[model samples]
Structure formats: C-alpha cells, structure tokens
Target chain A: MENESFYDFGGPEPEPARPSIGRLSTVVANPTATGVEAVIEECAALSRSLDGILALIVATSDGMLIHSTWSEVEGMRAAAISAAALGLGQRIASDFGQGEFHDSVVSTGDRVIGIYAVGDRHVLGVVAAAEDVTLGLLHLSARRTAQAIGRVLSDS
Target chain B: MSEIDVINFKLVVTGPFAAGKTTFIGAVSEIPVVTTETGTSEGREVKDHTTVSMDFGKVSVADESQLIELYLFGTPGQSRFDFMWDILSKGMLGYVLLVDATRPETWTDAAAIKAKFDELGDVPLVVGVNRGTESDVDKVVAALRLDEAVPVLACEATDKESVKQVLITLLINVVEQLEATVKGSI
Candidate 1:
C-alpha cells in the first residue's frame, strides 16, 4: 500500500514533465547542419509564399533566434518580445479557464504581428502589412507555416 | 485628502539565473504566480526551464491604517532578457536582489545586475542571500560592493517566514527613504 498523507487527500496528481527539445543548443552548436538548414528553409519558403508578410522569425521558446528574414539585431529583439507575448497569452488563457492557447495577434495602423506556437518548444513571429493582409488570411497562412515548421523540428 | 484605503507597491525580485527568484515570490504571494518559463538551452545542465519574460505575484498587508498591496515581479536573470528588466523596473517602489550563497561565481553576475538596477532608479534595495547563513551576509555585501546603507540578510527562499522577513526589512527601508524625501522638501 502506498503511504498517503492527509494533505494529499483528493488532490489531482501532477502531470509528467515534458522533455526539453534542446533546440537552442542544437542550432548554436552546429548552425550549418542539415536540421538547422531545414528550419531556415521553412522560414524562407513561408516568407516567399506570402506577399504581404514583411518578415518571418523562428525562435526558441527562450527567445533565441533560430532564423529570421529581418536583420540580426531586429530579429533578436522581436524574438524576445515574441517569447514574452507567448508566455503572457498562455497564462491568460489558463487563468480564465480558456482552452489551450493557439496564437496571438497585435494590430497597429500600418502593420500586424502574429505570434504562433511551433510545437511545445519554439515560437514563430510573422509581421505583415495591415493594409494588404486580412486577419483571416494571415492566420491561415501563419498557422500552416507553423505546423510545417513544427514537423521539421520534431523530425530533427 | 481622505485616508487612503489601499496602497499598491511594485517590488522587483531579481538576481542571477537559478537564484530562487520564482520560489521566493511563490512563497510569499497570495495569488497564483504568472510565470513565463521556457526550456533553457544554454543552462540546461543547471536547470531545465528558465523565466524568459517575467514572473508576477501579489500579496496584501493590511493594518489599522491602510491596506498595502505588494505586487512582486521577478525578472529573467539572463542578459538577453535584460530588456524585460528595464520594462519591469519602471515605477517600481524598490527591489530585492537575491543571490545564491552556494555559487559565488554568480556573485559577479549579481554585482553587474546590481549596477544596472542602480542606474535604473534611486529606489531602495535589499539584498537577500538565499540558502545562506547569517555569516554569508558580510561576504555577499563585500562581493557585491554594496553600500553600507543597503540591508543584506540571509534567507531561505522556500520558507514563508524567512521570505516575509526579507520583504519587511525592505519595506522598512522604503519607509525610511520616503521619510527622508518628505523632510528634504520642507
């Protein structure tokens, strides 16, 4: 028989921990490797497929930029902001009893930024021209790209 | 003006990576903490997940005079997230710089962080040495090159009572600073 404490009465058991993807180390350790190249190619393909999209950035959950169409400094800053926004979105969803968080969109007068989860370990940020892109089209395109990116990462 | 019913203060808890900032806030906060934890690639050997954005928690101290609400904000320790430090420190009443006693190497990082926060504001600061004894206070002060007025105290981040003491000590310092400012304006 298992020893149970009074304090443990009727409490839900904790979920098992998920394994870390170690994506940051893998990309940093060998940027030119096949797997890293595949992720970069995915970002490039996604950018080419969308006309209104201005930039596409793929970053680790911890805000390290894996690939981006933007310059290095701008990409790094966007990646950090993406991580913070993703974290805040997840927390708000959980707190309000909303279902699993999918994506978040920030719209301005001239531009829109969409942050989406790529699997459990990475985030994808898409910046687009608000005048040229509809919210629905941006969502559909970004969601598909995010899924493809997730597959590439999982296989890698 | 009528007696103030509620007063809110923003307090930041910051230090080097894995210095128990999250645990310290969770120990004292009345609400469920909002944490932006993500898998760490660089420091995976030390800890699996790290705070990429920030951690938020809240506690209230009610006395006969007024109700004080302390909003605790914990920052990501890595320099890459240093931008969050500035964003979080805006309008902060004061801050607590927690350092891990077991890892003296991180004290240098702690010192650098202290210097950054010092530039951010003239707010009061208290250094809490986690997993340390009373004897560690002196060493921490000397290593951090802290001012003589900064209170350095040993604390266990996991202990509620210990965490409370650290906050209370910082609150006392904050009060003293406010008093000094009011007197100076006269």
Candidate 2:
C-alpha cells in the first residue's frame, strides 16, 4: 500500500537558483576506489559490449560530464538533461512514497533514453536505437553495467 | 583535435516580490529559459503571475581552448517562499541582489534578504538596481548601508546587455574571490 504520508512534506521544494550540492552528494556517493579513470575505462568497455547503444555518458549528479562516447556538445546536452531528470525522478518517488528511485527509461518509436544512478555521486545516461535492440535487452545489459558502475563509484 | 577545458559556475539573482527576477533571466538566456511561475492571489493588480520556484539561464564564455559555462538562476522573491533561497544559493560563486528602484517601500525587505544571503556565506555580491538611474543607485546604497566598494549598476531587467553586464560584474568578483582563496590557502 502506498503511504499517503508523503504529502506531509509541506510542499515541493523549488529548484535552487544554483545546482544542488546536497542533492548531488546524496545521489552520487564517493567511491572507495582511488582511480576514477579506471571507471571511465570500464564504461568504454561496457559501451563496446552492447550492440545497439549509440551513445553512453557518465556524468556527475550535478550535470558535469565526466566521460562520454559522443562529441562534446552531445555529451554536455545529455549530462544536463540527465541531471534534471534524475532530480525530478527522485523527488517524485519520495513525495509519492514510492521508496528510493532506482533508474528511469524513456522510450519512443525511434530510440530509448536510459538514466541510472551510480552509487551516490554519478549517473550513467545511455541512448540506444529501438531498431537494433529491445527495451528488455537494453535493460538487462544496462543493469549489469550499472551494477559494475555502481561498484566502481562505491569504491572510488 | 586538442581538448578544451570547460568550467561551470553558478550565479543567483534574488530580491523582494515583483522585482523582475524572471524578466532579467529571460532577457539574457540564450535558450528558452525554464521557469516555474504560478498564479498570484486575486486582486493583485501588479502581477497576475508570480514565480513560485525559480528561473534558469545559461551563458558560455569561450576563450581559445577554455570554455566557461555560466548558469544563471533567479529565485522566487516572496518572503513566504524564501526557504528556497538558501538551497539555490549554495555552491553559487556570486549573486546579484536586484532591487526595484521604483518601489522604495520594498527596499527594506530587499536589504533583509540580502543580509540573509550575506550571512549564508562569504561570496561576492553586487547590487542591481532595476528601473533606476545613477542617482537611484546612490539611494539604494544608502538604504542598504552597503560598503562604498560594493558595485552598483543601473539595471533594466528587459535589456539583455544590461543583464549581461550585471553577470559580468559578478563574474569578475567571483574570480577575485577565488584568487584570494587560493592565495590564502597557500
């Protein structure tokens, strides 16, 4: 049963005039690992393992692109959009008593957008073509990679 | 191709009600700004709508291989909705306290809000006086009892160049603060 007590939050807190450092820390945790470069390399390897993945990006929860398989402009755009989406998703889940938000997927006729939280301080955004892969396959493949990414972040 | 360093910084615009926070952001944002405005109370003739959340804009400064991405955020000016200000101002490098020169009555409230942010952190701040002249700027300085060194500029919220100038002024201060911080730490 959904708890109606979520409404007790008084009201929705507006987006801060600046990107939120607190929320960023909550969403992206510090990894135990010393080398974030190793994680970036892992992301590159993960991208290669998927046949349909067109673009893969790793970014800070605060919208800074850390690494990407796309060009600079595309990477920046994805990072910004992912940060906004993650913040809203987290709020909605909390407010509606949906428990902690895990990940989100947006599907259209042509492509799919996947956003997954990595540990606490990072987010992985993926763009894949519908023609080349099913959402089920994408999720399955992406979930395993998300776990690895989460571990990397958790340790870093 | 060579890689370029892209840095991101944040700046906030805040003040009392109907202080043109939304207008100022809309005037300068290169892309269609994101805003959260809700209907105002009935019989409020001055404004039918008021920003309940915030406004966001972006500007990019590119020099050679370095790119500085500046994000501008405008806060909801009502005292009742003041809780968001602290959240928004966090991690901000600097801010512009916009005051409506035409509304001298609102000056005290604006100063109070400014003082709150001033207490929040030691970031650089500038005063942007809207719908005011050079002389009105002096009045604002006096009302706020601001140090003579605080930068004050005549701001027209609808004028993009004026808004850009305000941002530039804040950016300069941010750089200076950063330099000072680095030097102190060393």
Residues A1-156 of candidate 2 have per-residue lDDT tens digits of 121221122211221122212211222343323435655666666657666776677766655555666544445545555655665566556768678766889887867878887755567877777787777777777777777877766665
Score chain B of each candidate by TM-score.
0.95, 0.95
Chain A only: give the TM-score of model 2: 0.72
Clashes of each: 0, 14
Worst 10 residues of 2 chain B by lDDT: B83-92
Off by over 4 Å in 2: A1-156, B1-5, B62-65
Compare the candidates by TM-score and give the number of the best one: 2
Please tell me the TM-score of chain B in candidate 2 relative to the true structure's chain B.
Answer: 0.95
Error of 1 at A75 (Å): 31
TM-score of the candidate numbered 1? 0.57
